[model samples]
Target: MAAKRILIVDDDADIREATQICLEITGEWEVLMAEDGVEGLAIAQLEKPDAILLDMMLPGMDGLTILKKLREQVETQTIPIVILTATAQPNERKNFDQLKVAAVITKPYDPMTISDQIMSVLLTSR
Candidate 1:
């Protein structure tokens, strides 16, 4: 199988870099990073990565907004989306669940296990 491609949309530089490195080392997946929702939306349509790791909060558009936009578009409608968030409060997780997101991964995640966590989501989704 081809190496899986992962698009990460987050405003935090450190988080992006750390996640990128972790995914590369563990899964050897091709990874792309976007600073905000606009760039993320464009990249998601253009690159059509195997999966998306989207941050919950962004400058112009939030993750839920981006998710709605992507789900509205035919090109991105079926791609699996895993929300990366700092806080997974009960109500917020419930809200994201209603959005039909794959999962809401809280921040300060274990880098070593990040790929497995995401891959599990994808594999089970299939």
Candidate 2:
């Protein structure tokens, strides 16, 4: 089987690069990255990745808005989305759940375990 494709959308370059490296090293995953929601959406449409790791806070557009737009589009609606955010409050989790996000990962994450965590969610989601 071929490697899974993952799209990483974040405003922070460090976070995007670190997460990409972790995923690439941990699994047979092809990682694609975008700096902001606008770029992320464009790449998502073009690349049609299997899954997405999106930051809650972004410059051009927020993750929530991006998620909404993604859900609205037929081509991307069923794709798994994991929200990676620094904000892990109760209400934040509730909102993410309300939006039907596949998973929510808090910031200051363990780089070594991030890939495994993502895989776990993807496996269970199916």
Q: Which candidate comes out best when scored by lDDT?
A: 1
What's model 2's TM-score?
A: 0.94
Provide TM-scores for the models: 0.93, 0.94
Per-residue error for 82 in candidate 1, Å, reads 0.7
Tell how far residue 21 is off in model 1, in angstroms.
0.7
In terms of TM-score, how similar is model 1 to the real structure? 0.93
Looking at model 2, which ten-residue stretch has the lowest summed lDDT? Answer: 91-100
lDDT for each candidate structure: 0.90, 0.89
Model 1 C-alpha lDDT per residue in residues 20-44, reported as the tens digit of each score? 9999999998999999999999999
- For model 2, what is the error of residue 101's alpha carbon versus the real structure, in angstroms, after optimal superposition? 0.6
